[model samples]
Structures are given as C-alpha cells and as structure tokens.
Target chain A: MGTEIRVQQDDFSVADEYQQLAQESSCGAVVTFAGLVRELAEGQLDAMTLEHYPGMTEQVLADLVAQARGRWQLGQVTLIHRVGRLALNDQIVFVGVAAPHRKAAFEAAMFIMDFLKTQAPFWKQEHTTDGSYWVAAKDTDQAAATAWQDD
Target chain B: MVKVKFFAALRERLQCAELDIDSQPSDSVAEIRHRLLQQHPSWRRELLDNDVLCAKNFTFVDLQAAVNPGDELAFFPPVTGG
Candidate 1:
C-alpha cells in the first residue's frame, strides 16, 4: 500500500523485506530482487566502496519507483540500496514489488532495477589486489534501460 | 551563484567536491560549463568527455538546459548502481 525506499550503509534482510511486501493481502504476487557484490576476478577483490549523492540519490530512486507505478498496477514497492564499503558477496540492493498478478509484479521489479542501474546517483569503486578503480558504466546496462523505453 | 557539485571519479579527477560560481538566470548548463573550463582550464577533459552526465536540481538535463541563480548543478560519470 506504500512505497518504502532506503539508502543506507547497513545491509538489508531479504526475508524481512519479502514479508513486508506480502503484508498486502490484496496482492497475491510478490517479486523481489537482491544484488550482491561479486569478485571481478577470483580472489582479486578486496572490497568495494559505494558513493552516492545523498539528497539526489534518494530523489532519483523515488522518481524511479514512481515511474514504475505509473506503468504498472503495483500495490506496494520496496527499494533498498546500501552505500559505503562492502566486502565481496555482500548484499548491495533490494527491490520488491507486490501486485495482483505475477506479470505486473515481475515486470515492475525488473523495471525498477533497470532504471535504477543507470539513473540512480550511486557509483561503485572496486578495490582489488591490483588496485582500486571506479567501475565503468556498462553498455549492457544502458541497453537494458533503453529497451524499456520502447514500451 | 549556482552551486555546482561533482561526484565520484569526476570529483577525484577535479579534486573538488563542490563549488559556487557567479551565474545569471539566463545561463544554460553549457554556458556554466564553458565558464568553469575557462576558469579551471584543467577540468576540460573530465567535464567535456562524452560520457559525463549532468543534472540540474537533482534531475538529469542536457547542456542546453537553462539554469537560474541558486540552482544546484551536478556533474558525474554515468552511474553504475543497480
């Protein structure tokens, strides 16, 4: 019934988030996604630091959820993203959507993630055995976000 | 003055997190960028790169977008978050 958005330094629990989304009894389908920090090369990554524009980051993420709601009939949405240093395999983000059916829930969850990847004001810097470097924005990410524009 | 901010790698490259510049209500993002480059000269490469992204008042905008005094302008590389 409400949209929950959080940008924090602490990690989130998927089970807790899923339970919150499932609270809406009217919505039978609940779709959720969690992203993890992965090693670029086996045993190469030491940690990853996430930086974000504080005020702007929250604004953009809310805008993205609004955009998804406009396109889909969602009952409740929860979007959480973590900032600061994260070790490998750490949970980085979570997106959960609830809807009357699986189609809207699934699509809304995907749409939010796609748009957030490119539009959110968050950046990642990888600290590896070699050195620390900012991760480049991938073309594949841009393409995925663009594909939703066709709709 | 317009509040200009840089983030992530752009801030590291420019060695500046934020700064204020004299601006007129009629000035566009392009004009402000040009003035910035003229003043710093060294920021030309990072600011002018095709991959650089700009936002006015927390919303993405292009170079042609107009800016008023007291507005917030941010410049950064493309975002990589999911």
Candidate 2:
C-alpha cells in the first residue's frame, strides 16, 4: 500500500525491511536486493565516498519507483540507499518489492535496480592510499538499463 | 534566470554546486553551456565531455532542450548509482 524510500548515511537492517514488507497481507512474494561496497581493484581501495544531488535524489527515486509500480501489480517497494563514506563490504543499497505473484515481484525489483543504476543522481568516489577518484559509469550498466526500454 | 547545477566529479572539477545563469525560456540548454564555457574556459572540456548528461527541471534532457525562467538545469557525469 505504501512505498518507502530513504536516502541516508546510516546503515539499514535488511531483516527489519523484509519483516515490514512481509506483513503486508495479500502479498505472496517479496524480492529484495542488497548492494555492497566491494574492492575496486583487488584491495586497492580503502573506502568509497558517495555524493548525491540532495534535492533531486529523492525526486528521481520516487519517479523510478512509480514507473515500476505502473508496470506491475506491486504491493510495496522499499528502497534505501546510503551516502557518505562506506567501508569495504558495507551495504550500499537495498531494493525490496512485494507482489501477489513471484514473477511480478522479481521483475519489478530488477527493473527498479536497473533504472536506479543509470537514472539515480548519486555518485561514488573510490578512496585509496594514493588518493581518491570518482567512479565512472560503466558501459555494462548502460547496456543493462537500455535493455529495459523494450517490452 | 535559470538555476544551473553540477554534480559528482564534474562538480569537484568545477568547484561549484549551483549557479544562476541569466537566460530566457527560449534559451536552449546548449546555449547555456556555451555561455558557461565562455565565462569559465577551464570547464570547457569537462562540461563538453562525451559522458556528461543534462537534466532540465528534474528530468533528463538533451543539450538542445529549451529552458524557461526558474527552471532547474543540472549537468553531471553519467550516473553510477545503484
């Protein structure tokens, strides 16, 4: 019934998010995704600094969620993305979708993530011993997002 | 006046988050960028980078998109978020 979206610097509990989504009475399937900060170059990175357009970030996320809802009979979509400095292995993002059927839940979740990858305004900077550098958008990510444009 | 913003590495390079550009509703985004380059020659390469993307009033738009007064225009590198 309600979709939860958060852009914060604090850590989130996957179990708590899942518990809330599962409580929604008619939803039979819930699919969730957790993205973590990984080593950029075989342990060359120390941490990752994420930056975002504060005012526009929430707006863009809401639009992405709305698009997903339009395409699927979804119950609720919970999305949480962390900003600021994140250590290696720290969770960076979480996207959970609930639906009456497994297919809808799974497809909606994937669609949200794909769009988020290319459409969200957040940016990441990799920090290492030498210094830090902004992470460029991957060509592969662009391809993945583009695929969703088709029926 | 149009409110222009830069983000991510582009912001870091430009050392600016937001600025006001004197323009009209008939002005295209490309015109604004061209004016920006004239004022800040150092940003020409960064702003004109192939990967840079633009948004007008919170939605992504091409450089040729026209802008209206009070519109918010954003320029930044291709998003790398997930």
The lDDT leader among the candidates is 1
Candidate 1 lDDT, tens digit per residue, B1-82?
9999999999999999999999987999999999999999999999999999999999999999999999999999999997
lDDT of model 2 at position B62 = 91
Q: Could you tell me how far off, in angstroms, the CA of residue A102 lies in candidate 1 after the best superposition?
A: 0.6
Local accuracy by lDDT, each model: 0.95, 0.91
Q: What DockQ, on C-alphas, does every prediction get?
A: 0.88, 0.83
User: Model 2 segments beyond 4 Å from truth?
Assistant: none
Write candidate 2's Cα lDDT for A72-137 as tens digits: 999989999999999999999999999999999999999999989999999999999889988878
Q: Which residue pairs collide, candidate 2?
A: none
**Native contacts retained, all candidates in order:** 0.80, 0.84
lDDT of 2 at A74: 95
